[model samples]
Target: MNDVIIRTEGLQKHYVLGAETVRAVRGVDLTIHSGEFVAIMGPSGSGKSTFMNMIGCLDTPTAGKYWLDGQLVSTLSEDELARVRNQAIGFVFQTFNLLPRATALHNVELPLIYAGVGGKERRERATEKLRLVGLADRMDHKPPEMSGGQRQRVAVARALVNEPALLLADEPTGNLDSTTSEEIMVQLRALNEAGQTIVIVTHERDIAEVARRQVHLRDGLIERDFLNSTVETTV
Candidate 1:
């Protein structure tokens, strides 16, 4: 009723491994509205990763319904799903998935290129996004030449370049130190404040606390869904 951006009803994912059918997500029901910042927290082997993949449109659920921006994702074909993924979602991974050989600007411009954006406009838009993330000066630098924080910043810039409706980050801070992780969190918080819907999957409590709402997963089921006490005022 609240203008849901993502809704899942009885979502389930199962994998068959050597005669064993393992249920990764067991009947998950969730609704996240626009402008919400949510965190999925769980220990290793939990279904959080599977859930994130499903939500991010990277993988399809074995069963159940997934409505993204009011459209039933499970009904879409592979090509249709790819289009929806490009138009509606942006993803940030734990490993800064930048093209090591490409410059920061180039990495950020990849999405636009895939969408067939022209050269001039792509460069201009990429520059603006990188600047928004405080990486304007590093646009020409390649990932290997930059620090971990800088690489992550570039990744964030890339995630935002398309102006997607949803940003899905998987353990975004897993590779960074505490200080650097906080810095990236600050950037993500700012994006959420700017009305970007975000769903982050993380195992670290401190990182999860940065979000306004936290959903805990255990043994392929949601154990808790609650609001954070220390609301992100800075965002």
Candidate 2:
């Protein structure tokens, strides 16, 4: 761990559900340094999802401050948040989120397209990331043409195309079989070991075990945050 890539102080998010106000996250203070691999875990209604949204910049918090890669992001405007997300953070979802008609290379180039990178550069970058994820041979294949794990590998390549400061994955292996799930986790572990700062929101204990640290959220607060005892990594 080097620089502080993620920091949240008294982070909170509340939702208005007609007559009821739901406090999805309440006063969570957390910090994840550069090169750290962390997992956020909890059962249903435990606030892990809400907290992940805040971290990913997909949703703004109702209160508190958050800094991503040392930039205060909690108060960023929607457009500004969008820019920051595109440049600084990369996201992976369980659904794969690929365009069924697009080739893996083109799908990986989507973020660069949003960022206005040149087509040539975008292709080059996407190509490099696809190779990084061991999907070089499948770059020309579309989502519908690939297997579940391969499609998710394409998703991973897409997430890495931007060279983001943080890689955030939410239930990344939820749709995969147990074997495929392990494969994704192994990929994530390899990425982290190679020094890509990573964070994942997963409920699977085996998946969570792959991370260097685990934070368990419950009833809108962090119930536990600690380094993996078996890994021997510093806090």
Candidate 3:
């Protein structure tokens, strides 16, 4: 099996703003292997968000090459990128981006539904994901009926329903309390132990401490990339 999940070479992004050009990502060369959990850490305007967008397939790099799950993604057309995003990447946003009115199971099933999965398989996958995330009993509950943590768990379930190659989370704990954030982190760590390749993008140093590896970004370039020797190994 291919071990490299993500690889980038000379990745750069620029925005033209009314005569003044903005350099979002200067030049980043990164490689993330399978079954590895990593944190993309950076502060505001550090190019973390732009880098996340490129890696997530939500935006294309202005100058560079990107490979996702062994495919050349930097040059893929929009339609192709969309396909890659749906099949190879799963995203969990900070706001617990779950459908307010849909049941947890239904919300988790949205991706499969979009992928044209049959109703039976969709339900089965969604149920399994919810169960994996410790929300088996809350499958029928809507986002409004659950606490912030539970809702985020549902979002995690939804992201996993597709069995993505990479689980990408953006400031996942931004909306949760300390206790709840730890709960979610424990759940994520469990998933990582199960061989899932996960990447978390965040500005919070504490939150990044859980990852085994961290890539620090500054001014659109990687400032430091190293194994996190001080990772909190306890739940």
Candidate 4:
């Protein structure tokens, strides 16, 4: 009743890999409230990635229930899930995931294009988002023309273009250096301070510390859930 943005009850996912049934997620029960910044931390093969895929609506749960923004996501069909993903969530990947040939502005506009937004509106909104991420001057540059941090900033801008209820970042700083990672964290902290609900997945404790709460996953089950002590001081 506390304005939950995401809720999952007994969520589960299983994968068959080479005659072995891998239980990626086993009964994950979670509640993420609006405007909360949460991090998911786990070792490799601990099922955090699978959990993120389920939360982002990129993959279906093998069983159990998931609700996003008061709607039953686990009950939705593939097409319906796609619609929900476009409307309710934004994704930031470990890699920048920008097209090499596309300009930064065009890369940021990709989501708008899929959503069928008008070209003029897309350009205006993309520009505003890029400016917000401190990439206004590099709108015309391609991925190869930008540094790793700059490319990631473009990806962040793209994610924000939809203004979705949830921002999902999966190892967003994995590809960056330590300095750049801190810079990206600074930006994310600022966004969270501005009331963006964020769910970040990372293996690094330093990175996970940026969030207000942390959920630890092990062997496809939640091992720990606690409030993070390192709150943003400057943001």
Candidate 5:
């Protein structure tokens, strides 16, 4: 059976700036199955970010439909979308959005805190996720104390601590150097191997190459959607 984790039909987002209409995303129909690692690639103004916002439940579409894990989220209220985002989506960003003063473990525990998880359980779960990202020894270290790669790993751990069904990474390697970028991609590959669904948005072909499938967008439409038969299967 094909377990579709994300499905969108006629998804569109438009905005008006003093009579100038901006069609950010126009009629994007997409499907992402469970455990698949996919990348959404596009140049600036190509609407990839708008498309990502729609699927990530961070923005509402002006028109169209969206289904996430079989739930119709397109028409959901803001509060409902918030609930779904917290329970089903994990977000990794270009910047390692960590609290400057908090330790790595505490930073990872933020999601659980928002979910109202108990202290002991939250600590244990955050610890496990940090360890999964190879940051076991840096639990007590603050973000400033870690290297660029290590801080991003901490961000990844925070994203996974909630055990979200879909992981949305937006320009995850944008800030890292070539070597550190590869390190992050390798970690993402391992997470996919362990059955986490991921969708990354990036303009860099090299970063997108790490994903098994690539979807190219242009002018708010999908230009190509194909499997990367030659994508490296191992880190």
Candidate 6:
């Protein structure tokens, strides 16, 4: 079996604004292996977000190919893409996207519910994931009852309930303080160490340093992709 969880060749995305065409991603190529932790960093309008969307199956490219776990998803229909997304990807965004009225367990159970899992099994799975994120004691707590970090942990737990093949985090630390950001990063780092393949998009250099590899983009194209020998071991 192939270990390459993500591979893209000559990937391109363009947008037309009136008569002018904006080239968002210009023939970019990338590959990420299983269990690898990678960070994509770039300034505003650098196409980092666009690239993330493409790889996450949230958007399609105008040109080029995207092979996710050896499956060509760039050409999949909307319904097919949604199916692939639910089965293969977990997303953690800056906003912690939790239901205000739901308990952490219920929030985590949402994904499994969408996937047609039974009530008993969904509860078991959600509970296990919350435990993995160090929130076993907070299963019954609602979003309003938790701190920002705790809410983000709930979001992380929710993301993992479906056992996705890839975890895509977009500016996960953007809404947290420095200390809380590190706290979240610690949990994410632990998850990666336990064999979760993660691709995080961040513009903060410190946040990006936690990953083993970094890919930088500029003007809609890759500027550099290199191993980070000095990746921080601590959150």
What are the per-residue Cα lDDT tens digits for candidate 2 across 121-176?
99999999999889999888999999999999999989898999999999999999
Candidate 4, overall lDDT? 0.93
> 1-235 in candidate 1: lDDT tens per residue?
2579999999999999999999999989999999999999999888999999899888999999999998999768888888888888988999999999999999999999988899999999999999999999999999999999999999999999999889999999999998899899999998998889999999998888889999999988889999898785442
What lDDT would each prediction earn against the true structure?
A: 0.92, 0.92, 0.93, 0.93, 0.93, 0.93
Q: Which runs in model 3 stand beyond 4 Å of their true positions? A: none
True-structure lDDT of candidate 5 = 0.93
Per-residue C-alpha lDDT of model 6 across residues 11-76, encoded as one tens digit per residue: 999999999999999989999999999999999999999999999999999999999988999999
- Please give the range of 10 consecutive residues that has the lowest summed lDDT in model 3: 226-235
Screening candidate 1 with a backbone cut-off below 3 angstroms (N, C-alpha, C), the clashing residue pairs are none
As a TM-score, model 6 comes out at 0.97
Model 1, clash count? 0
Off by over 4 Å in 2: 232-235
TM-score of each: 0.96, 0.97, 0.97, 0.96, 0.97, 0.97
What is the alpha-carbon RMSD of candidate 4 to the true structure? 1.5
- Cand. 2 TM to true fold: 0.97
The per-prediction CA RMSD against the true structure, in angstroms, equals 1.5, 2.4, 1.3, 1.5, 1.1, 1.3
Off by over 4 Å in 1: 232-235
Count of clashing residue pairs in every prediction: 0, 0, 0, 0, 0, 0
Q: Candidate 4: how many backbone clashes?
A: 0
